[model samples]
Target: MSPAFSVLMPVYAGDDPSHLEAALRSVVDQSVRPDEIVIVEDGPLTDALSDVLDSYERAQGDHFSRYRLRENVGIGNALRVGVRRCEHELVARMDADDISVPDRFERQLAVFERRPDVDVVGGYIAEFDDDPDDCFACRIVPTNHTSIAARARFRNPMNHITVMARRRAILEAGNYRDFLGMEDYDLWVRMLSNEATFANVPSVLAKARIDRDYGQRGGLSVTKAEVRLQRSFYRSGFIDAPILLYNLLTRASVRLLPKRIRGRLITRYTRTPG
Candidate 1:
């Protein structure tokens, strides 16, 4: 029998209701369905978003549930709280604006079956502007534990929106914490330190929504967050002084470039055409 898993997703004010509906529909139409889906309302949502959730809940009946937070917490904290309420050992993370591929869960589960020592299984994700079917680029990562660990020092080794991880492994690694844009990166680093084994399916697991203006989003605050993240990595011994300085100079400086330049740089190096 396949292992039971729960899909954990969090949504807030900024999420698009239409995108959320599409996201839900993608999972619902999966080749292998989840036992349940636990949605976290990070804060009060617009009536439109609430209505979308309501429809899914009504349609899914007992298979769907939601937990509302009294106020807005960052995605990391919201997920930290929400993951605790999941009723299964394996939990897959989802984002309201992303659509999972139909066989995503089945593929990840197959990895776990073949590699029982793996604590986390993730795969590549496609980045699309308007339609999931027409992806422009893909974010691919290393497939084995060794390469994943080595690459984690320079960049995120797994797609946060496409991972199926063991709840026990996550809790042991300290769960998700608030780190602005660095939450998933931080957690993965900690999990690596905890000696958790990981693998990737080497195929698209989900399609993440991106805007044409993706490069224009970062600013001074983004640079500050990058600095803070590097410092944490240093303090945790994830990186040494030399590697830390290298990142501050190379990665942090990239963040301060003109929006067009930054976007071009990211698109040139980080993405592959789908």
Candidate 2:
């Protein structure tokens, strides 16, 4: 028998309405559908975004649950609230602008069934522009526990939106905290520190939207967050003092670069032809 899971997503007013629609459709049309989808409106949304949510709720009926916050809370707090509302022990994270492949959930579930020791599993993502059919690059990550743990020392080892995690483990690791752009990374570090195991499916299981503004998303503030996270890892003995210093200097330098240059560098190194 297949295990049931809840898909958790947070939508905000700033999201492109079309992208939100596509994201919702991807999940709803999955080969192994979610038992429930818990979507939290992080604050008041634009009429269009609200309409998109309304359409999905109407179509999905009881399978879809919606929660609205009185005011805007960041993704960290928003997700923390959403996770608490999930009925299933397994929770999958979805971004408002990304599209999960039809078999994504099924593949992730298979990993859980075969490896009970893995508390979290994510997969590669194909990055696209305005059209989903035109994928430009794929972001791949390490696939085993040891490799993932080592990678987490210097960078985020998994794609945030592509992850399916154990609800108990997530809550036990302190749930999500307000970390701005580094919220997912923060939770991952905490989970690793708590001895939660991680893995990634080698295939691209989702399509991530990337545009000119991608580079601007990680600025000085994000760099500060990374430095803070790296320090936490060092203090927790996840990495040594020398490794921490190396990470701090390199990450900070990258973040301080011009957005265009940073974007080019990221594209050049983190991406490969889809």
Candidate 3:
């Protein structure tokens, strides 16, 4: 039997209305539908985005729970608030612009049932641009707990949007924090430090939207945040000093690259032919 879980998603004013509708539909259409979807409005949303949410609420009824924040507090805080509102002990993170495969929740639930020690389960993601039907690239990560722990020393081993984790474990690990562009990585580092088990399903169970502006979101500010996270990990003994230095330099270099060059590098290193 599939373990019941709640989907936690944070939406901001900037999200594309059409994408939000598709994302919500994907979750509602899951093979093992979530018990509830706790959506936190980071702040006031555009009329179109609000309309989309209202329509889902009407269609989904009690399965959709919406919360609002008076001001935008960013993704980390938004998710932190949403997590607390989740009714189920198992909480699945879903981005407002991403689409999960029909069996995504079912597969992750099976992992929890088979491996009681596992606190978090994620999977590979197929990245698409303009059309969801045409996914061009896949982002694969380490599949086992050991590999995931090792990979965490250098980079985020889990895809945030593809993760389903125990709510208690997340809260115990200090929950989400404002980590700039690396909130998920920051949480994973803390969770690993606290000995929370992690794994990936080794299959593409989600589709991420990576439009043209995706690569442009990173720059010096994001690089600084990455360096800060690495340093924190090293100090917390999650990563060694050498690994910290290596990440700082490498991440900074990538952030300093020309936008076009960085975009190409990101695509080349992060994605494989789907």
The candidate that achieves the highest TM-score relative to the unseen native structure: 1
The Cα error of candidate 3 at residue 47, in Å, is 0.9
Candidate 2 clashes between residue pairs 3 or more apart in a chain or in different chains: none
Local distance difference test values of all predictions, in order: 0.92, 0.91, 0.89
Which residue window of length 10 is worst by lDDT in model 2? 211-220
Q: What is the C-alpha RMSD of each candidate to the true structure, in Å?
A: 1.1, 1.3, 1.3
TM-scores for candidates 1 onward, in order: 0.97, 0.96, 0.97
The sequence of per-residue lDDT tens digits that candidate 2 reaches over residues 86-184 is 999999999999999999999999999999999999999998878888998888999999999889888889999899999999999999999877889
lDDT of 1 at 225: 86
Order of all candidates by lDDT, from best down to worst?
1, 2, 3
Kindly list the per-residue Cα lDDT of model 1 for residues 1-274, writing each as its tens digit: 7899999999999999999999999999999999999999999999999999999999999999899999999899999998899999999999999999999999998888888899999999999999788988888999999999999998889999999999999999999998877798889999999999989888999999986548634678988888998999999999999999998997888889988888887888888887
RMSD of 3: 1.3
- The best candidate by lDDT is 1
TM-score of candidate 3 versus the correct structure, residues matched by position: 0.97
- 86, model 3: CA deviation in Å? 0.7
**Alpha-carbon error at 118 in model 1, in Å?**
0.2
Model 2 has an lDDT value of 0.91
